[model samples]
Target: MNVTLRQLRAFVALVRTGSFTAASRHLHVTQSALSGLIKELEHGLDVQLVERSTRRVQLSEIGEAFYPWAAKMLEDLDSALRAIADIKELQTGVVRIAAPQLMACTLLPDMVTAFTRQHGAIKVRLVDCAVEEVLDSVQRGEVDFGIGPERALTAETTARPLFDLPFVAIFPPDHPLARLNRVTWKDALAYPMISLRGEYTRRLSADLQAVHPELMLEPVHEVAFMTTAISMVKAGQGITTALPYGLSIIEQGQLEARVLDGPRISRRFHIFARKNRVLSPAAAGFCDFLVQACLKQDWVRLPEAVSR
Candidate 1:
């Protein structure tokens, strides 16, 4: 009852050293202070913990029983503190992130590789899901955070701006549109277009219609994943539009990307997380690193507000 760590330490030090002077030296406290602590501990416990003598000290029956318990408590606390220190220093921890499958395959892999190389002990786990499911993973507590294009956010979630990149037209290297330095929406739409299904195409169409009503994204095919669209483009099925961040996949597909102008429609990407939840040190650190990585890319135009 009302026992303090200093009192327990003093009792343990006295038992281990077998003398008041030695215990005081071990604790870097004066002999009188050490004696006072020991007295306080015994008084609080209502037991004579130490048999004090002029030249030696010994633990009483109750002290002998409590020594192991107190020592264990201190040892466990120290171990926990060390573990926290390791996490804070980025020496060891896990950062769980979710993203659209295309980003998980293209942009996130490179960024994760760079981050892990710098912080060798920290592990980054990326969950690849549908573009629409990125925020669902975050809300369900499946990931520490998520990266995806801006969407209607719910009150249970928070979004931090990551990148605002202009849409680019992607086609095979030999395609006629590849000749242009920059392709317009009309130019890209001239060919059979393959667009992503659901919210993505809807948002792009809405943005386009807002500026140029006559120009619409009437795609010949609507696919779920960007890779599928890119694959189709590579095979000469049709051309597609995507943000510049997917250039890696486009290049790997033996395709080319050109900036799409004529209203210059852009999409904003954000880091999504559960509202009012505190991110771990590793998660927060990786989020900052990701923002810096995006900043380094010339094509990525970040918003005025940074990550929360």
Candidate 2:
């Protein structure tokens, strides 16, 4: 405890090679500095650590008993330091993310899997949030990043456009458009529609309005979330629209999904990171992986079932 790590290292090297010059070379230090460190350590412990003459040096009684202990202690300390370095250098730390429920189901699971494989020591936390909540969390510094549709974001945050997901029609198997591969917006117009209402905190209804301006999107059944909208479609009550590239649980559970070609209401998936904020090295690497993932255009491919 009274001695420094340098002192212990020098002592170990001197004993291992039984020569001051060899220990100095081993430690990359001058022989005089190494001699001072060894003497300082011996003086602190009040023990005769080394027997020295003009050209020869030998361990004393106390030094003989301590040689193995000092060497082992230094080795253990070095190993611990290397482990901590790996945790930081290898992108091993906790990262929190805010994602929309649809993305939590559609894209994030696979992304998380790949990320964890490469960085097994990193801890990841995923929050199933609305698009507006995701934006708020990222801006407020509660989350490292957010993934959702691109909307009006503050200038402090930088967003990368990931992909464009077109609208898909959701209907029961017995519905008229169920048999079609791709149904036009006019096809949906013929029937009453159900939709997620009050899903976004912002006053702007960006997705629907951006797609259909001239025609009214008569929401016969207004629900609070995507799950509710899917429920309505399953009940044979009315049909709704979803992201063509993204899959809903309703696709496998109770309803059919058809791509809509005419209205072509697609959205830009954006990855949000606060601008000018210093990110931890691990978080920055994770963001890089996210960007590479976005460019690959592989998020839309869904497996047969949800692995949640």
Candidate 3:
């Protein structure tokens, strides 16, 4: 009824090498010790597993039948142990993340590049979608985590604040607003604005209204994606407001990103993960690295209570 790994290893080695002396040499064990292990294995299994002669060692009928199974067991065990070691060393893993399109295009790429350089063995997969989709991805267990703005986290998901990206005005380089050191929300509202549709626009309006009730945001264009809004701004259609996180995209579109003041409005981005799920070591490591990288940025304000 009792079995041990040492006994199984000895049996398999004896079969492979075809001699107790050779098997002992391969295992770095005394021949007597190797023979004793085989005896113990045979006694425990209540079967004769080897036929021995002065000239050679061969597997008996029962041992021959079990050899394949024993070899397979050892192979599987070795693979499992190696995988564990790889995980511990951060030498193998996949870190899946879902993030808003704007962030995926801007803030995330730099973080990903830095992370992959330091951890060449670990792979990162990013799914760029809407803010809502990012939340859904984490809640549905589709990603190791999500990075986006604050949301109504379900009981199945948790959010940890990463950083707050102040709302910034994105405008074409030659636009009059771009000439200022900083653009005020009031000044931003006066322009023909290109705005994001749905929740983002609503939140911007609501938050701005709470602070400056007399203010109004009337957009000449409303788009589903930030890229579209950026496109509109680049064409000199109008200015748009977005978190500074997407500065790369704005810069790519030949637009300038200046912090919006007059009462700085910022959107807080969070790291979202399943409530009870344990992240892979690679994912956890990336999360820590991302927080530190974000903190180094001048515009990213980390909450005082946040931790690695």
Candidate 4:
């Protein structure tokens, strides 16, 4: 109805504190004022929110269900107001991102960390899922943007190449390919392998076939995740190839890798946002940070001079 923010705030205070006196203390209002606000809210909503007996106060069933939602409404309202205030003060609002799972695991944590350290007030929520899921979420305006292999963006979405991720091979330290700085595509095919069981994997196989048109590769097993495929290779199940950071994940001490010599097989890691999505200031800050971070890593990881 016509309930005001102040009234809602007062109701939340009493609901949280469980008594008018305590709520009055916390709200810095007289007990009578807090009690009056509750009465006004009941009149507006035509329901009893608080049950009053001498010993204590309790929320009616409707009040119990309504309190959390009311609190969230107030919280969201406050966040929006604060974000607007920040804009005037040169700060951005929160940014919610849904990133591809493997990239989220290896890359996003660092991006979020550095961004938070730089902009203390900007809020960031990063959700991790597969490429298809990321695309769907962004399309639905559930996230500000996504990073991974760019699938075809829907008409309502926009995407751009952020970077290229070369497919690198991972083998145990003593494996045959380990001694070589780079091994040819045909050389890689000769080894038993584990690989992702998705479009990316098909692309890799096709890329291999480009160099060896007659060649065919059937992995030991197809997996749903890049990390899992990498793990399989590291456990010595067989050798495998993955996006560059898939190799970086190895450096975390659970695996190892080397550049695969081929026709430069790599996937485009792209930045995607819904065509008409409204991004909060915080989200926009994160988007900029992610692009910059990936660019820096690209510079740093461009096949070391020794390997080239």
lDDT of each: 0.87, 0.75, 0.84, 0.76
Model 4, 245-286: lDDT tens digits are: 645476544555666665666678777888777656666667
Ranking by lDDT: 1, 3, 4, 2
Q: Estimate each model's TM-score.
A: 0.94, 0.72, 0.86, 0.68
Q: In candidate 3, which residue pairs clash?
A: none
Measured by lDDT, the strongest candidate is 1
Candidate 4 residue spans exceeding 4 A from truth: 1-82, 88-92, 251-254, 298-301, 304-308
Per model, how many backbone clashes are there? 0, 0, 0, 3
Candidate rank order under TM-score: 1, 3, 2, 4
Q: For each candidate, C-alpha RMSD in Å? A: 4.0, 5.6, 4.3, 9.9
| Candidate 3 lDDT score at position 105 | 85
Which model, 1 or 2, shows the larger TM-score? 1
What is the model-wide C-alpha lDDT for candidate 1? 0.87
